[model samples]
Target: MKSYLAAAVQMTSKPDLEENLATASDLVELAVRRGAAFVTLPENFSFLGQETEKVKQASEIAHKSEKFLKTMAQRYQITIVGGGFPIPVGDGKVSNTALMIGKNGEELARYEKVHLFDVNLPDGNTYQESETVKAGVSLPPISISPELGKIGLSVCYDVRFPELYRQLSKQGAEVLLIPAAFTAYTGKDHWQVLLKARAIENTAYVIAPAQTGNHYARRTSHGHAMIIDPWGLILSDAGEDPGLALAEINPSRLEQVRRQMPVLNHRVFG
Candidate 1:
């Protein structure tokens, strides 16, 4: 019954970078006190403002936020999965990137958001992330630690694409990290279902941290950040507010579910 504690942090990030970072730090400390060895932050945990504002604050991949992540990991002495933040790549476009840092404050892995949100919502909201963001060319198959298990990394919109998850599982991913800032309109309808489906189908643990509440006049996120087991059971849910959801990732249980159903073994197509 090998297992380890993991946590998902939900937040209602604001336009202010320092304020948002402070909120995230508090939540991370809460998760740490709760005994989580692996903690994940929500998308845009450091800043969630207008597109122009995001670009203005964006730093190159190697600076600012990266240093913040390293320091946090070292201070906490735990693995930290940093959620998406803007990383400038020139030409007024940035990359929405996620990072995994080891307890020793070393970089473990990085995942750039491959899918950009370019939808016209029924609630009359339109987003064109492609305008200021560059899509990643590949998915990241990361393992923070041998005992922690191999991880599949993805961000908000990437959850809608199952092929990405499939590819990750194929590459030996046993845990999936989906840090998101899902809009209230669509999240209410699809968030939980999508999370469960991915876990059940992959027979893997799915940990999702999310942005909750309103960030601006035009933006609101549906919270309910959660951790789901391979059996598709909701081990923990953060509800519709800023908080932390904690759960244990049981590797033996994951193996049990996979052995019982064997869906991954029976897949006839890639």
Candidate 2:
């Protein structure tokens, strides 16, 4: 089908896993009620702890864990893009991974975040994602359905890399899913602009679900969950709040944009 409802869920997750899952479940239910076939959650939707060591300690193996993801997906009966979670990677360090679960609660694809957020903002806000998380070496995009088209999966920090989006578009991604827990400082400055740029330059729909508000230990996040079309038009946006934003994905529009711009065909660089 050319028309499909997509949702971006904004959450303010806390350190408590149970509470976080509850909040996520409520939002997912709300989105499904709004007729969204595919719903995306924000990064660290299960746990947004302040300490890296705490997150590492809470990391779970995706295959074995019967926790938040498995239960949520099955209960919702909708394609749920579980936001970035701390997953054990066999090494001492855990990988910040995003899980895509189908309607039947089966794991569809797993995209580990390749680019880690390592920045020292001038506001004395310093983050070293590499401190407790390991980087992913491979760049593999996931396809939900041939009709829905291929989607390039990315986490919070990966939004900064334009090359990744270009590569994904080159690899035939019509839509890019970015689930992030961006800091308020950076999100206000770069969130919408970067998302729109990615959509405009790649000629692809950008689906970004963000974590908003403060979580545990005074950790604050910028929450502006949005869905943008291929022509750089924002279909829907959830401002700084805990809610859901719905938009219809039109393949015809995407085709029109690509046909008009043809940037995907004009690319010559690596």
Please report, in order, the local distance difference test score of every candidate based on alpha carbons. 0.90, 0.83
Candidate 1 structure lDDT: 0.90
Best by lDDT: 1
Candidate 2 achieves a global lDDT of 0.83
Candidate 2: the clashing residue pairs are none
Per-residue alpha-carbon lDDT of candidate 2 for residues 17-69, written as tens digits (9 for 90 to 100): 76777788888888989988888988888778865544555554343333566
Q: C-alpha displacement of 198 in model 2, angstroms? A: 0.6
**Candidate 2 regions with alpha-carbon error over 4 angstroms:** 60-67
Candidate 1 collision pairs: none
Q: lDDT, candidate 1, residue 28?
A: 85
- Give candidate 2's total backbone clashes: 0
